[model samples]
Target chain A: MSLILKGFGKVLKNKEILAPINLTIKVNEIVAIQADMEHMNAFLSLVEGKRSYITNEIMMNEQSLQGCEDLFIYRPDMGEYKRLTPEQCIQFWCDLYKVKINIDNVLALTELTHIRNKKNKHLTFSEKKRLQFARSLVQNTSIFIFQEPTYQLDLQSKQVFNRVLNEILKNGGIVIVFTSSLEEGVRMATKVFRLNSRGLQEVELGDEGEKEAEVKEDETDSLIENDTVYQRKFEKISAKSDDKYILFDPLEIDFVETRERQTILHVNNEEFYSTVSMKEIESKLIPYGFYRCHRSYLVNLQRVREVVVWSKNSYSLTLDKGNEQTVPLSKSRYGELKAFLNW
Target chain B: MNLRLIRVLLLKEIKDLIWNGQVAILFVTSILMILVFFTFNQLEFNLPGHSITMFKGIPTTLSFIVLLVTMYVQGNLMVEEKEQNTERLLGLIKVKYINVFISKAIVTYILSYLLFVLAMVIHGYSFENFITASFFTIPFFLMFLFLGTIIAEASSNTIEVSLYGWPIFIVYFVIEGLIYSSIESRFFYLFPNYHIERGFSLIEHGEFLAVFNYIYVPIIWMFIILFFLKKRRKNSKTILNSGFS
Candidate 1:
């Protein structure tokens, strides 16, 4: 089944709140739409049929979405029966959806089995979010919509959500995520779309071009010789964006490339400008399995999913970050990458 | 209209009430009022034209319990969902609003009647005309239930319930006092409290047929409140979609 929206838009007081959007989300496909809070809510309201649209049409399997809402399960960021225990909460949802399933299995899937008897009000924020995920899981609907599913969750909670998301997709369920964070969109979905006043458009990941910059040979040779000792100096790489500094773990960096003489660290399709030179950053990251695929690109070997050959001398390495995330692979380094992997 | 859905919702309401400490306190207050009234009747205080009998005052006591428990419990039931945002989940699940409303009304009705029976047993009153008394009180209970729903729908939280609920609760009794003072006015007939108090008085005199005469007023008030409840719910949906929390 496919969910289709054609020219869907909202207007209030003769002012366009959301521009007309058209998209089709097919079964077993995960799609994410990133927008500001106002537009996100406006778009969600339009889809949920809570707000009237000046011009729009939504259909699921060629049926109007107006009266076929039961096929969709919306898991908003906020909303839970705080007074009910996790088990009771799941039971209530099961009964409401008229489905019978093993409640314990769902609790364990959400990692709330340890606190199955705990009231939702007493659970932590992440636990509550997992419980919400469990509630939607029991409904067993055809389509799932999530709003900021991992907004403030810890690493462990995010993994749990990813597990549930995989379970749904494996069962042929269509998923749509609405978030304000682009990184979150790319991380959770294969097809990431951005909704703004300009309307809906798919975001092309890893399409930014890189520029070569001269690196001093003496500085790189010295760091490469003592890379083991240099690796022990720091465990996090510091990058700057706007007025704030962010420290990212080496494992989180998908790849790094130089653009216009500035080193940029790419993590989950987002770029952070780095002050360290390419030679020093590559030496520091070499021990962590980073390969200098090109003069302008340093690719994390652990995140490389496939090596694509465009021609004899033209090649690119696809990183497993999201759809179409590829970095330029220099033909000279192709033999080295193969030998490094023992191919 | 779905029986299974109604049953599931009823179970939810029952469990929620059991876990709520505030509602438990309301139940305890009712028991305490029963004991207090039972003791007062035992003393047999006799003054000319001021004698207090169990039959004469029991209806007034039950009416108070009905209003207090129904308003506080029903109002909290609705407001707590809004405060916790579970109402939106209910909407997403496609649970009919009528199903939730019916479940709450049934719970409130059973709780009020149980307290009324306990009050009668403690006061040593007979169940000879209990069915007639129950019929006379049904409309009043419904009136307060609808009124409580209106207040809950208009309120965003429990504090707002008290803010708006107490004043209206006080007015019900104040109006009852005015009607009882021999102040002849058709305006008094507009209030459900007048019908409730007058219906109970008719029951005390064994005027069962006359009790029905005062029932229509509360029924009319209930329909009016029901209309307002529908309108308030529509406005609430507007507020929800407008992102005007």
Candidate 2:
């Protein structure tokens, strides 16, 4: 089933929550929407059958929201409330949806087989999230609306969630992910929409050059050459400190970390402080071979030597230079970093 | 209209009550309260050479018991679903809200009636009195069950429901008692159980038509409560839409 929002506008108490939005989503398409937390929640509320638009059209499978079977499945992010074990919860969902039981496959897929007998309330946040996903897999739902599915989850558990998302997409399900993080939008979506006070707008991913159309003789060849030229331009970045400045090779920097709101540049044997915030530095350096490994640390992709999993959810990245300088890696961004490294 | 779904929901309610030990608590308390009140009434009023009327004190005791059990069971059901946020799960399908509401009312009514009859049996009321009195009293108790549902839906948690439900329930009886002695206003006719004892007295004397004036008051209260519930449901939906607490 496909979803189409045509001039969809939502208003609450004389204040417009969502301006007129025009978008069409196809089956198997994973659309991630990034916005302020409040607006994001309002949009999710509409999607999950909690609210309806005041003056617009929303159609799922060519039908309105009311009595639409195609919009049957909506799982809000709620804490575990059932007194039953995870295994029983999965079975109950299967029975409720009148689907066949595939408990073993669900347990194995979520890596929750070991804790299958534990009551839902006793499970950790990630475990409970996995149990919810397992329950969803047992039911036959055409569209999956996930509100902060990765919230408060470790990187490894996020990959488990990512796998579940991929499985849903593979089965031609509509996946709508709502988050407040732009990194999450880049990580999960092929297309992203931004909701702000001004209204909804499409967010273009990748280089500004890619967004423009070139009327060259060879359009395909020109596109390839343009990408390579864009890549060559970001080989190095300059920084300033104490009335002195340096045009340093970005590859020579092992990592850039933020401490106490100060952005510190980390080289092999030298450190330079920048007045710019980490977010400012990140935007300038991301086009280069730099990857944000954690909220505090951004590493030069060429300097990363090894990916280490110290524990189930704890991880670190070892740099190739400076006696194998170690940098803390966030679990939330670990999978994206590994994918960027192709490791 | 889906009988199977209604059956499934009713069973779920019963299972939840049983698992939570509410049913057992209500059952044992009802029997014990009956025994205590039975003995107390006999000793206080059944003096030497004087005949004690079984019906004298039964209505008041049963009314209080109905209030307690309805708030306990129906209130628990309402707050539990809202607390756990499982109410939305039911809305996932095409089930009518009316069906859901009626199903809960049916289950709660049956449980409350069972408690009443069990207490009546232990109090040693005659079968003839039991049959006729229950026929008139069931509607009055059903009104209480509906009010209990409104209390449950209006409140957020178990503690909040009980804290609010109990005071209003007790105050209702107090007002009714005051009205019975001091007021002859028609506004008192708006109450569900008003003139219930008088209606029963008329029934005992075979004055059947006079009972309609008493019974019709509860019918009006039912419609009024249902109207209020429908409006509250709309308000809750609006609150949900706004995504505010």
Best by DockQ: 1
User: After aligning candidate 1 to the native by TM-score, how far in Å is the CA of B132 from where it should be?
Assistant: 0.7
Candidate 2, superposed: residue stretches over 4 Å from native: A11-16, A48-56, A59-69, A72-123, A154-157, A198-297, A300-343, B1-4, B21-28, B45-57, B92-95, B125-130, B175-195, B198-214, B234-245
Model 1: per-residue Cα lDDT over A90-171, one tens digit each: 8888888888999989988999999998878899988998888886678767778887787777556776887888888878
Model 1 lDDT, residue A264, Cα: 94
Looking at candidate 2 chain B, the ten consecutive residues that score lowest on lDDT are B236-245
Cα miss at A219, model 1 (Å)? Answer: 26
Give me the iRMSD of candidate 2, please: 3.2
What TM-score would chain B receive for each of the candidates shown?
Answer: 0.85, 0.80
- TM-score for each predicted model, relative to the true structure: 0.75, 0.69
lDDT: worst 10-residue window of model 1 chain A:
A206-215
Best by TM-score: 1
